[model samples]
Target: MADENAVIVNVLDLPIEWRHNITPYHEVRDPDLVQQLRASMEAHGWQGPPLVCDRDLYEVNQDQAYTGSHRIVAWALAQDDPSADMPCVFIQDIGEHYSIDLGELVEENFGNTYAAVEQFVALLPSDVAEAYGLDNG
Candidate 1:
């Protein structure tokens, strides 16, 4: 579970143009892992949303993948749909060394994290949503 201050949002929550604006934090070095991820997603849909950093906090700029960059790439390759409704859990603070409050931004743009997640989940494809047990949300 995330800390109390963080919000779990998704790509669908962002404006249409921003949905595909996210980028990997670094170059993917393991092609084999990406292939595996692609296979898994093709068979099972998304296991879970990727964790992302809300870069620039106050603006709808490019977010960076904190985890699951490989999965993001795999999804893109597998689906050929960069604009697909991909889920993401946004972190406010990485650790004591870094503290950026993205939750406030989420609240400013989309009420609150919980509401945003509910709204996004409802937009997911039934099969995909059901696989994550988020179909009822």
Candidate 2:
């Protein structure tokens, strides 16, 4: 059960304070990211909670927000009777609040996959090395 005090608002009613921070991550590869998500949502409904963190806890000067926030807001915007409200979870207290470094999270998520590629290359048989311009010697 969720706490009665835990704030849950419609996707439309979300104020600037709650949403001004969230950042959306989109890729050119995701051609229908905006369309598909909204379409599926119309048929069904939102299955996930907004990724929120305490505002008063950490003071990040140059910070970015959690990924996919725009989509959540967009989904709200497309509704016929859109309220644009969404849940905003906050840490209870200044001392007890927990949040992660957004920069680190982004770096981790978007880190280069060179290591994986190297591993795949290492697995290739030496017999094919000459064919692929490799000299295992």
Candidate 3:
């Protein structure tokens, strides 16, 4: 909903003041995804930390609580696994200002059958939606 797309800033770029752990959003991964990611990691090693943020991660927008949490939890769980310790980069203080385009968000969630962009967008502030030219209603 934020006008500007979620800027993929370097993990190192975030402010020190923003660091905080609200805990990862837990989910029982589908066996297939776990297997697939496991295989990918075996061959490539942990690519990088999953994009994440602290409790106050949202800026112009809100609701990473629902959409962005899983991405972090999956990476954390993977890292904990004895087999594949994928080192994940946990982000802090991100939100509408950090959000990428709706299409980009959808693409990031590619494997999922349903579109969460609309749902996330719905949770964004009115100003955020308007910024993205999405709050037509």
Candidate 4:
């Protein structure tokens, strides 16, 4: 389970190896989407903090992202210094039994939105959905 508490951490403080897509095969390469995200971050700043799981809890060497790959990417792209630390929320108390069905959770939380649905449909295949028990059919 993830700890309800969140904390501020620097983007650069995050381990490079752990910066991975939360949803498998959901790498967003769309320049337009990236641009839009960058613009949003530039204008309003990071509204939602990225969710990170503690690697030590999972016996891993580095912390991993549970969500917010796009935001991290946008922060990297929008900043004058990519390594500069920006305020972010890090999820604490993630244990070894923590579920990897993050994609489904994100979709379930935001699936009604067009962008969320588009991204979910674009990246998540039926097989993966089934594996995560997120398949509608």
The model with the greatest lDDT is 1
TM-score between model 1 and native: 0.49
lDDT, candidate 3, at 78: 45
What residue runs in model 1 are displaced by over 4 Å at the alpha carbon?
A: 1-19, 55-60, 93-137
Top of the candidates by TM-score: 1
The deviation in Å at residue 13 for candidate 1 is 16
lDDT of the structure predicted as candidate 3: 0.39
Off by over 4 Å in 3: 1-23, 55-92, 96-137
Looking at candidate 1, what is the lDDT of residue 9? 36
Of the candidates numbered 1 and 3, which has the greater lDDT value?
1
- Report the alpha-carbon TM-score of model 2 versus the true structure: 0.35
Q: Show pairs that collide, candidate 3.
A: 5-99, 6-98, 6-99, 6-100, 49-88, 49-89, 52-91, 53-91, 57-94
* lDDT per model vs. reference: 0.52, 0.37, 0.39, 0.42
Stretches off by above 4 angstroms in model 2 are 1-31, 53-64, 80-83, 91-137
lDDT per residue as tens, model 3, 1-137: 11121233333444322222434344545556666654554455434333342233335332233322333344335445422222223222324355634444556678341354455546667664453333432
Instruction: Give candidate 4's error at residue 62 in angstroms.
Output: 4.9
Model 1 has an lDDT value of: 0.52
RMSD of each: 13.2, 15.1, 12.4, 12.1
lDDT at 58, model 4: 40
TM-score for each predicted model, relative to the true structure: 0.49, 0.35, 0.34, 0.40
